[model samples]
Target chain A: MVAFDFISHGFIQKALIGGFFIAMLCSTLGVFLVLRNLSLIGDGLSHVTFGSVAMGLLFKLYPFYIAIPIVMVSAIGIMKLKEKTRLFSDTAIGIVSSLGIASGVFISSIAGGLNIDLFSYLFGNILAINWTEVLVSFFLSLFFIFLIIIFYQELLFITFDEESAQVSGINVKKINTMLYLMTALTVVLAMKAVGVLLVTALLILPPVTALQFSMGFKGTLFISCVIGVLSVTAGIILSFFMDFPTGATIVIINFLFFVLSLLFKKIF
Target chain B: MKETENVISMQNVYFSYNSAEVLSGVSFDLKKGAFLGIVGPNGSGKTTLIRLMLGFLKPQIGDIYLFGQPAFLFKDWHRIGYLPQKTSFSDNHFPAKVKEIVALGLLSKKRSPKRIFREDLRIIDKYLDLFGIIDLKEKFIGELSGGQRQRVLLAKAMVNEPELLILDEPTTALDPETRERFFDILKEINNKKAMTIIMITHDIGTIGRYASNMLYLDKRVIFFGTFESFCNSNDMTEYFGEFAQHLICHRHDTGDIYKKSYGRI
Candidate 1:
């Protein structure tokens, strides 16, 4: 039987709220990530964050704050390198993403013996969320959502055809760099609760499922969020019952939704 | 739609990439309401010239003006619309609906969110209706024939009600009927809407009859004037003859002149 005291059980409530916000941001941003043909970028950059977080832990710094700035700078740096090299975004992502995984493993090994709990960073323990983290996630999610709404048109144009976007007065290079940074930031935030390895799956799977059968951008966003909600709700329930990892379970649930969407698209 | 000012002008333009010169001392002036068709062989700088005029790359020498402003400025470029050589390079599974693809053109003008502006909607409707494919709007773009996708792209280019419309090799992938239909639409737009157009293509047949001004660019401004003068050029006897032969031979089922000339222009 569950305890009746809701206010005192802030951690439980906070985890749920954090899930809601994380679902909202990742799912919405996932649409753009998919549209730009950069779903892999989310996966790639999350590894970079993994490396950065490991760096923080090695230096005994607060991992989230330290990882945030590093992720932001590296996102911008990778974008700049892409522009100068004129490579496809995927190739650039490949290079940056590999750098992340390689660096994370390299630094952690050399710094000291690995802490077993540090392995939990691969997939988060959402059940351990505290009040401050929950509040921060909620507002950051809301702010990111608002910013996305404001620049929705610009982002769509850039995604559709970057040269056309530029010709129509959009500063596409700036917007492109900004989007990579946004993806990096969103992944960094989610890592606190969802963790690094699983955050990308959460980011991509929901929107990709929605896009398989949806029409308008708004429809895609709405459907992705709905799918995200279902995954989170089910993941939380499954975690409670099965004694499973919450973050990994959420990602798996969303992946199941993606598969279902693919099947439905085929059948329909 | 705006007054026919000097929409694009270039002077003594020189361009190159890694020491191989593409455009050498080429100068051309495109006024408002002119349909300038640039025709040349493969690797003849037709695409490069358009890129230069669009300010995709700066000329090594001279200057280009767009909407009376320097070409490099961001606001100066907003007055233009561009359609690439191919609409999309998809095999069989591109996920965009035709309507979704058309909406991308309108995306540039949206003032708030991803909402379609009323004017953009009107333009989309007008263009789809103008091209007589309003029914194809909800269909998947990948499911479309090449011609249908080209029409959708045309709608996208026109959604801005752009002052200058630039197309690179627009009709290459189309069947003959669709190709003619596409040109007819362009001709009508030239007559009625007075939209300035710059068409760059290797298909000399489309250029011979329709081009108001011809810019026969090789490595430089080979010829820049009316199509009549281009056809009458001492050198174009061979170029036009080959193209005219191809054109006539294509419509030869109706016992056109090509049958008598044995596909020799």
Candidate 2:
């Protein structure tokens, strides 16, 4: 009854709905990223989001709107640089990541201290998600899920054997670019539920947990999404009752799932 | 496609990475339905040459034509199957079943949102059985042994029924018995299906027994001719030294024969 009443509140309801979708999207994409050894792309892009949000604040623009394009374009640029330059992928990501955090601190300090609104964005506030954000997050998540499902085979082939895929005429470059863009978009949208710092945990942990038990590609994919959604929902409710921060709680729940999976693998 | 037409043609191809030249003044032509064995020592531009043929890498100064069209513009990739040098997955938790991996060959040729039709499933089954891996279809690829994994990848490449099959050091991970069986399968495919095959291997004797032609490469064209001519040519003596005949006749499976024949290669 208490859980029901808590969810009956409009903001809480919105958070639950949006949180579920974001979880599903992040974990689904995470499987591919993990398989391709590109898990740090999420971390790199989320840090880029920090700079964009700060710039938006200083310019007196809606930070959400400003962060979206800036984060996405920066994500594409980082990926391109990684591919083209002599720097390794980790080095490229490190460069972008440090630049992002440094610029964000500089801009926010120039404007003033990290205010309440900016702090909320940094750490996340599930209860603060309005209906517009909820609707947009829902549809975008749905569209990305649909795209992933339809392209599972090609994506799997590319991830599994990139050289063979290129020889077989699967435009590897185009597919890679599309994946990077979608990852950036998901990181930006998932901000309200997990914030910039913890969004990568959402992207990486569920897939890592699911990989412990899954025997095949399809099994890993659906199972990852399932684990993600369950963790997010459970985290939201538990945080409400336990009076903990929702974002951190969700990440901790995901971490717990990963630990449990490790134990389960060892035992079985 | 005339029977005598060149399926792959490389004319004075030159390739370099940064400042280092990998292939300089390399030239060769593979005829239709011919089994061309590409043999070379390590770091001899064997893989790089194949990459150029597949259009994965562009040559700095040469022309490469596939089926009479330039390699860059020849878009009918469904007619070609490629198995790369590295069969090992970087990720330990690679989650793909044998059947799913085989099905990727056909899926790579299709448009997005492609469905696995009943016919496609039948084809997958046919190739799995052909590779004697039908019972292992549901097994995860990561769980399989090295030989079994190679068979699964071979099935994946054959599922599309490509006219040209290219394998790079395919027997690297296989046991001797499995390697023999693999060579037999390739020979059978080449003879029965009349498929053109280009294979890269370190085992010259084994490949020479099955391959119709040979290309001995080391950053340039050392020799390109029929296996019989390769055996008789003075170029063989110049390249492999006095043990050229021993290298051709002695199976590497016997202890240290290949190493003794090629000394520090």
Candidate 3:
């Protein structure tokens, strides 16, 4: 009866669907990103998306469309800069991230200063989920999943041993660029569920928790997705009953699960 | 030997990093199944030479060929298996099974939605069996001993049944017994499977026993010839100084090195 009551609410239903899809996409990319030691790239790109979203809002254009291309290009740019300039990975990420937040602050200040519309993008308001946003989230999430599935083995090879992958004719540069693009896209789409600031947590926490179990790569991936989806589902329900912010609730739930996983790892 | 029979050929190959020259005028030709031990002191570009041959890095000057094709155009990479030096990024917390790591070799040969055929599994099993890691295939690779992890990495390299295998300081972390066992395995792969090997190491006394051809490199081809020639040549004394004969003869005497400069004893 309680489940039916919750499902009957349109906004709640849309949030649940959008959250699940975002969780799926982020968690899948999370596994490889975590393993490749590029987890911070997710954080950096999300901040970059924040700036793009602000610019789109300032121009009265669709934010997702504007954010998607800019974030993807920035992702590849960051990787190229790191390689060509020999900057440390974190140093590159830090440089891009500061530029992102500064641009967001500057644009938002000029465009009437953190309006309700911008606030939703900054901290996430799942209650604002509309039919069009839901559809966009679904397609983006599907695209991310399909891309990863198709290049699953190639990604694995490159992530585990890049030299061997290149030597074995895997076209590592192309695959890496594709992976960066997918990660950027996933970070942007995840903003609907967790807001730009917290999207990296959605991308990293579940996979980090899954690593506690010491399962094989496939198993780890499966468990990470499960953890991600389960956290969002539980957090949404709890938020509905307790009247809490949806995004923060979901992230806190994920953190709790990570702590629990650590306990299990230590005890077992 | 015919030019086509050379599995790897480098002529006057030079590589530099910024202003520093890592390799200069390096030249050698490895035959179809010859085991080449590339020996050099630290910072002498032994690893750089291997990277050049593997096409991981390009030579700034001269030319290199793999299986008769120019290094850049050599599209057939699965034919070569490589084990890099032990000093790599290792996260013991990462969850990768031994079998999964080995299967990466096969996966690297394919695109994804990879159909893991029975043949692939058979190849994986065959190499796992060879490395005596069949029991640990399901175990976490990170949890294994350094020796066991080395074998898993080797299994990954050999899973595709490569025509050429290259290892850089593979036995550096292994104990004496494990190191000897590893060499024995290399000998088996070299003799029985006829897989050509190019190993970069400082263990001259040990590699002297296995490598058919030896390249004593110090930023260049100090000597590149048969093991017998390497032992008898004056370059041996030139490279190792007064201890050259002692180092070479130590192999027959105790099969160990007394000098730390040549690598671990």
CA deviation > 4 Å runs, candidate 1: A1-9, B1-5, B87-100, B103-115, B118-120, B140-143, B235-265
Q: Report each candidate's C-alpha RMSD, comma-separated, in the order given.
A: 4.1, 3.7, 3.6
Angstrom error of the Cα, residue B132, model 1: value is 1.1
Local accuracy of candidate 1 as per-residue lDDT tens digits, B107-178:
555444557656666667778887777899878776788777888887888777777899988877778777
Worst 10 residues of 1 chain B by lDDT: B252-261
| Alpha carbon lDDT at B59, candidate 2 | 95
Q: In candidate 2, what are the lDDT values of residues A1-268, reduced to their tens digit? A: 8767997888778888988888988999999988877788788888888888888988989888998998888887877887788576678878888888888888889989687777877888776788888888889887887787777667888889877887777877888888888998988888888898888898999999999995588889888999899999988888888899999999999999999999999999
Q: Rank the candidates by lDDT, best first.
A: 2, 3, 1
lDDT of 3 at A154: 81
Query: DockQ, in order, for the candidates?
Result: 0.40, 0.58, 0.53
Task: Please state the Cα-based DockQ of model 3 relative to the true two-chain complex.
Answer: 0.53
Q: What is the lDDT of residue A267 in candidate 3?
A: 96
Worst window of 10 by summed lDDT in candidate 1 chain A = A1-10
**lDDT (Cα atoms) of all candidates against the true structure:** 0.75, 0.84, 0.84
- Chain A TM-scores, all candidates? 0.93, 0.96, 0.96
Q: Tens digits of per-residue lDDT for model 3 on B11-109?
A: 999999999999999888888889988887899998888888877778899899999888877887778888888423367876778887888877646
Clashing pairs in model 2, backbone N/Cα/C closer than 3 A: none
Per-residue C-alpha lDDT of model 3 across residues A85-183, encoded as one tens digit per residue: 989778888888888888999999999798888888987776667888788778987877777778877877787877777777788889889988888
